[model samples]
Target: MTAPAALAGFDEVEAYHDAWWDEIVAQAQAPAEVDIYDKDWRFLSTVDDAISGDFTDLYNDAGEGKLAQLAANPVAQWISENVTEAEDLHVRVTQSHTEWAGKAQTIEESMDSDGFESMNISFLHDLQHAKKIYCYPNPFFLLQVQWPKIYPYFGPSVTGVKTLLHLNLLRRYQPFWRLPADIFSKTAWAQDFEAANWPHIVNPRGTGLFNDTSMHCIIATRMGNFYDVVKAILEDAGLQLTATRWLPGDEQPFPEYATITMPTLIWDVVDKGGVRGKTGTLLDGFMPFVRSILGDNIQETKTPVPYEEPQEYSEDKWGTVKEVPAVVWYAAQRYTTATGTGQSGIVKWRKTQHKAIASAILTGGKSPGWVNTGVKLIANAILGYIGMIFLNPGLALGIFDEQIEDVILAFARADLTNLRDEMGRDAYGEYWESSGQNGFSPSTLAAFRTGQMAVQPYTSFQVEVVNGQPYWYGMHAVMGDRVSMELGMSGVLYTDQIRTARLTFGPNDPVGWTLAVGKDDDDTSPTARLARVLQAVSTIAQQIAVQS
Candidate 1:
């Protein structure tokens, strides 16, 4: 069905966002006097309006066929609208020190006055110093003190903080890849079931879960960092990067991954189980785990098929021809333990039947010491599972699988290595170091430690200072340093680093007078931090209510 005509047009979307922001500001300015519930409804209404317009459905009627609809989520819409692929992107990692270091003594002396103006002046100085370092004027500094008096409930309303966190989590924990058709393809798995005289055993339909449409919305919009770009370059060169299979479901929605009966590699068994001799066929020997959601009807294949000329062998860490398994047993989908599906029959079926099948195949008939069996018990903390993807056309899901930090650092190292190679002794002047102390200047840290400052801390990379300036380098959308300003600072001091320089170029701010912060990841800016704090508080309150 087409979207309703009342849906907002493209030109009106930005205006709609502005109106919502204005309303949020007004509500935050006088929350006690405003109808908060009504405001919430209005906010939801705005989201509905933003999503009402027809969007390009990436996944064509994938499982439950709601992937397209789910893509209309506010975060997805915002990312789709705002973030575009960059071409010939040349990010200049510059070296420059923060201007605040010079004014440190002045701020400290002003703090001794014990007057309100002194505090205000110090705060302004910090903001000015912060602007020199951060991409925008530090909003956290502006709002931290004034929020209590001028805007009581302003923190949670800020955009981009939670989204950035979610993006980081996805990039860090659940990097994605497309499922290739040849090795673990739907066609091959289905053929195996039919060949085993269990035609009715495995379902043939593609769940469309790993399809580009389903995974693209979750990833491309989230990972626009330089690391992601480099990873893309590496993947284009045929490096199947391994990432944690953090998604908590044992049962794979894809039918190809439903059963575990592929011809096992000798090296694979030796690598996983440690070298032990004497066995019939490789398949019979490696049936340590196998469970099917289709009950006893789906029996394990006893007779093993010989390797019919292994086609696409991937190189392992040692550069050996590694036969990439069609589907890794442990890296399947899993669901919550909560048994009774809530009221709706659809929910019940999805929770019970679909999940049971997914869980069953995911477990693969739990053998001793198998991790997939208890996947739901332990959350993402257990980083044992590995998520793999197929990068073939029409089969790839757009998800980042590598740690962004690692990618960025690798780039820096590569760039530095090249520079050193080119200049020899000339490049020895500057170097890159990880930002350990949450990307705060010594003055900023001291101020925050003493409760004199309320700005959020950013964890960033630092390069050596050359010619009195610190070098700065980061992507257009960088990860925010997730330290809470409320928490007391407890880390070693770092100074004259690259982070003290601008991380991103503001397209709109030609003069750079924009008083915003956390534009990179959009999480640590004062407003973003405030919103995060408020959300955290709200969550705590909700938890308390539930406990009570």
Candidate 2:
């Protein structure tokens, strides 16, 4: 079915995306191996040959599927938007700063007093030193798409590099990968499934859960018209723009923001694992722990074919290949325990029904002593009995634009730069009454401007001032988007070293929130942090709404 006429461009964009995917795959070159260079962490570096030599392997290997799913993203579009935006922004800032500076001098000269000393200092500082920057939410998956639909790898990389983290996570946690596909895809594990009798086996499809980990930030934002841009962001959060009104006297819209609210959203889990109620006790914990160490393993009690049937050959980690019986298996029972003086072996399973991949380890001598039959059996039982309940974290349902009006009002209060200093502030000391862009090339330095839109504490540090006095002293540290400031009298440290806004999360900002979410991943921005905080605030409210 076609979307409504209102969504005209959306379909075309979707078609473009499909075609783009096909084209990129054809254009994609798979080398023997690609050495990944990570400046921050060497352990993150690896040689990805999964896409290196063979096309067939590329399709079969899991990593390529994940990368291919994410390739041809509109990163170029964002880069281009930012390039033009920087120039335009530089022009706007210089013009505003010049006009404000002129009016400031006249007001200050008329009233000079000691009490006004701090006010003068503050006023002068704002004009000559403090900066104003533009900010807006830039969440990944800005469209109404969910992560699982795009980032199928289940867990987004902490480093924001898909290929790097996917490979690293897989290599680092091979054991975790063995989890049932449904649980692994959700990046969750059932630590205690025995209580529920591992319900997933009876109904595998019911275990999947959704989590809304959407983080809105600047680095991840794409450039677009203001109206359409707001709508797109809202859609990503499953919201709608229900109102639009012009200013009292102006033709332009008043605030240019949308009011987003979820009147109702319900999720009732009546079966809240009253299943694990037995395991809740201190005594129960001991039994589970003992069972865990030795494994309350369940072994296959049935096989479709006899153990004597011709076997299949499988390779082991130690390079040896062995033949194991080929058969379909079903049904497992708890591990066999000692009947008398002692137990004969850890577990007793029908050889015909044993899984070949696992049997290979036992026969290939790769199984460690700790991995005795009983331990293996119990581990398998726990994994199969393990089941998890999930609640879709739903996309970024945060009212990110919630504080837009407040933020804008805060910026409006900032007076302009003064007349004399405005000239010095201008390039070549030529102050244009009607400001000129001149050499004000928009650069990354604007990222550090303190306040709401400020990126310093929210994302990274992008500015470098050399042998110059600090500006935050007289000015409020609030940069742009509502960022709380963390500058001391020492201000910014002047060093010759070129730094990206990679590591500077300002002073009192929620640095930990985005630490796992990296700047390159476009998930580490002030908007993302604020949105997360706001969304968390209403979890119970949302839950109640859901129940209603």
Predicted structure with the largest TM-score when compared to the true one:
1
Predicted structure with the largest lDDT when compared to the true one: 1
lDDT string for model 2 (392-511, tens) is: 333231354232222211111111222223234332221111010111111111111111121111223222221001111102111111111112222221111111111111123211
Estimated TM-score for each candidate: 0.15, 0.13
Candidate 2 minimal-lDDT segment of 10 residues: 56-65
RMSD of 2: 34.4
For model 2, state the Cα shift of residue 202 in Å. Answer: 31
**Clashes within 3 Å, all models in order:** 30, 36
Model 1 scores a C-alpha lDDT of 0.21
Regions of model 1 farther than 4 Å from truth: 1-470, 475-526
List ranges where model 2 is wrong by over 4 Å: 1-167, 173-177, 182-463, 466-548
Candidate 1, residue 525: lDDT: 56
Q: What's the TM for model 1?
A: 0.15
